[model samples]
Target chain A: MVIPITTGKGRSSRMHEFWEALTDPHVDFLRIALLMGLLASLAFGMTGSLVVVKRISYVAGAISHAVLGGIGAALYLQTVHGLEWMHPLLGALLAALLAAVIIAWIRNNGFQREDSVIGAVWAGGMATGLVFISKTPGFVDPMSYLFGNILILSRTDLYLVSILDLLLLGILFVQYNRLQALCFDEEQARLRGIRVGWYYTLLLCLIACTVVLLVSVVGIVLVVALLTIPAAMAGQHVRSLGAMMALSSLLTLFFVSLGIVIGFLGDWPAGPAIILVAGVAYLLQSLLKRVAA
Target chain B: MSEPAVIDCTEITVRYGPVTVLDKVSFVVPERRTLCIVGPNGGGKSTLLKVLLGLVRPQSGTVRVLGREPRQARMRVGYMPQYVQIDPLFPIDVEGIVRMGRLKGRGLGFYTREDRMATRQALEEVGLWEQRREAYINLSGGMKQRVLIARALVNNPELLLLDEPTAMVDAHIEARLLEKLKELHNRMTILLVSHDATFVSGLVDEVLCVNRTAEIHPVERVRDKSVTRLYGEPVQHVVHGHTHHHGEGEEQPDA
Candidate 1:
């Protein structure tokens, strides 16, 4: 259900309407959407830091784009094959993990030029997703999945996001040192007897999980923006990875919250609004830093 | 007889798809002695180091580092790679980088108090303890190289392998690093690889020259014959308190 915008009403009334929609017991989708955004910020902050530091934003981008294939397949399967249990989110997770593993394998094995393989996977996954999406029965709006509607998210997505956040935090707690080593210097990590290949694959898998979490908030097309922008911004000011993660998490939370408010106020799509705030903030920060320097 | 060998390799051969990088190379480095492997670029100096680090497996060879297989002895061996392999923009500090040396394949655990202590000691040893909190990217090239040394020393390993530690540093930093290595020579076995013969001439107990094949010569023998033969060109040889420039320049004797 689209939240009706009081176009002719004053700004205060619109905010009141948003606040009421959030607190109303009978209508808690807005509250749920806000909670989903906040929880997803944790995963985004951490994984995005890793993606930026390891210089694998391209790999993360590939994984995010590839998620479309899984979403499309799930939609097709549920509609055409009568597989009621095939959730699009599950399909997205699987496809993301598969794409991550394949990319990691190619990188470890040196089977092909890594960029070429990444390019193929990036384009191939999108094409596959589009084909499956078109083949599905009924009038499904692909735009909703390509660019998400956080306002329409269900309680189920919220639970999934919470669970993923916990899993990501737990893994990070245990593997922080190794992951740091892997990102900093794989060869030294190897000499220190850390399994570089396994850790690399594991890092990618974590990135995959984070991408799926992001998909729920920003959809497929804009997922890379949210995954990278806040982290990049945080990297500019922070001196260490942990600090970068914390600062980026706060930045993501800020952008997400402000974007949601702006989207609600203007009756705009929340995802793009969030990305715009983040993009503009990043540009302004860069300009300020340059001027100050 | 000589001291028990800390590094013993017999007929080790490494090839990358028929391009033989190290062909039947053999060398022995005794305990507590510094061995410098000097050779030209693409002469398998780095490849030989990888073979010892168990990073590159040779086609046929028996290799022992600290009397055990390279992989088995990896935990007790510290390695500083030739290049600073990390991105300069990486958000890590000197302490963070050095702490990586304490990772021991445990898969999941934080650094222990002992790990912290070792990191401090390593940093202090390299005279970078004051700058431990500094951003690695903000450090000078010399300090960055020193940080890598501190990382390799953090574990207090029995063997330290440094590949071209003086490659990019200026002369002042090189002398400082040379002094640091001299102090370390009293405790651990050091295997340093460099293409520049003059830089390592004073510190090494022996020189292992490699150009696809390998040969070991005493430091005294390196001044005239071995270095000249290995590089296939006349080069400067710095012996104790003396400098000899071959082929085109006069020999300048130092006090």
Candidate 2:
């Protein structure tokens, strides 16, 4: 019920209303959502390109969910123990980074059951979150964190996302070749005196940070789809990693805006709507490719 | 006068858990020499190559390339692994693949003007210069293998290591490719690991037979019996276009 639905409003009128609100300077909430959506899309494009090229979508998923444990712990500490210093976002960031580093370490060290370890971490994180949530004194609505409500996004959240997006761009810009080499042939990269372990851990940590930023808008469950689908679609049409990132960012922006409009008129959840739009696009693209072939 | 060794190893031992993949192996390759390493599948051929490239750390051996540690000389060495199938869906052109060879230092973005020139030169060497802009996924199998070689060559290293370069190439292409390799051999030191002796017959100056251990001898000293003994199985060697098969008990030429 966050976005009000009208009985007789047509799609074109709704779009006009949306356009007016977007251009209006006084409509700060809508503006905040727009900025957050654009910044989040940028992060999604950069990290999604790495995730798909390096074939680590599942690890990105585990990191996204593992951040929930941090959120739950922060809430429990602040509410039940009266810890004023601990914040949920901080907790989420720390947990996400730790989970990413641990999973990447396990993989690089040649663990016998790396996937099983990822699964364990994934489930363990969710379980820990559930436990903390149960122990907290107040009744907290889980729906907001599980399926995102962009209406709740604050100006501070927009600033935080912008900072994270800047960090991703800076690091990716500086280490583009090294990262590309790692994705193409890790063994060759290692032979070239590039520390495969160091860069791999860095890549995962970047994914972790991006996941934390994404969870604020899409929640834990749906961020992976948002991260991957646009990149995969762009991959089919582009010839380089850089092109994929650029094109996917535009595609992600389109999906996010479309989903926001749909959610507004239908009074539905925005995150899932955005994912559905992307998923349907992927399916259609695949079918069209098969037909053309 | 003796040329300094481009590669020198002393008592190198590599182990994976309880399995000793390479056992106290030692060898030397002088500068500008073409050395071919012939061994069985499990006889530590690729492992030896890894040791030379510093990809695998030996428990006890000291390795030096160009009078420096293998790790330090990595930038000066170029390598092509055995036919590793790149995902056909990978979205990179042939030039992009070869440009990876020029990735020597930490760079932030796209290739430079010099890097592009080197990539073009490498592609032309392999006779695939015109196809530089073609998607790597669209190339034929033989073309892909050649593309990998061009990638290894783009860096213009003083020493090149190739593992089974012609493993998947067609018979006719393999012969022409070996001829091309012989031309490249005059300019740089080359270390190659291959099981197809017929293809490498005249291209190699020396053959190092490895079977958990290693021994170096001139190419003329390698007979069908020596290969069979190294492999511990029957080996067929083509001499003067005739296949000569040898068994384990067959007499080996001078050791």
Give lDDT tens digits, candidate 1, residues A129-230: 999999998877778777887888888888888888899889989998888888989898888778888999999999999888678688888888888899
Estimate, for each residue in B59-107, the C-alpha lDDT of model 2 and write its tens digit. Answer: 9889998889888888888898865646666677888888888876454
Candidate 2: CAPRI quality band: acceptable
lDDT of 1 by residue, B56-146 (tens): 9899989999999999998889898754666889898889989888887764658989999999999999999999899988999889998
- For all predicted structures, in order, the TM-scores are 0.94, 0.91
CA lDDT of each prediction against the hidden true structure: 0.86, 0.83
lDDT of 2 by residue, A185-239 (tens): 8887787667789899999999999988778677889999999999999988877
- Clashes per model (N, Cα, C within 3 A): 0, 0
Task: Highest DockQ: give the candidate number.
Answer: 1
Candidate 2 residue B3 C-alpha distance from true site, Å: 3.5
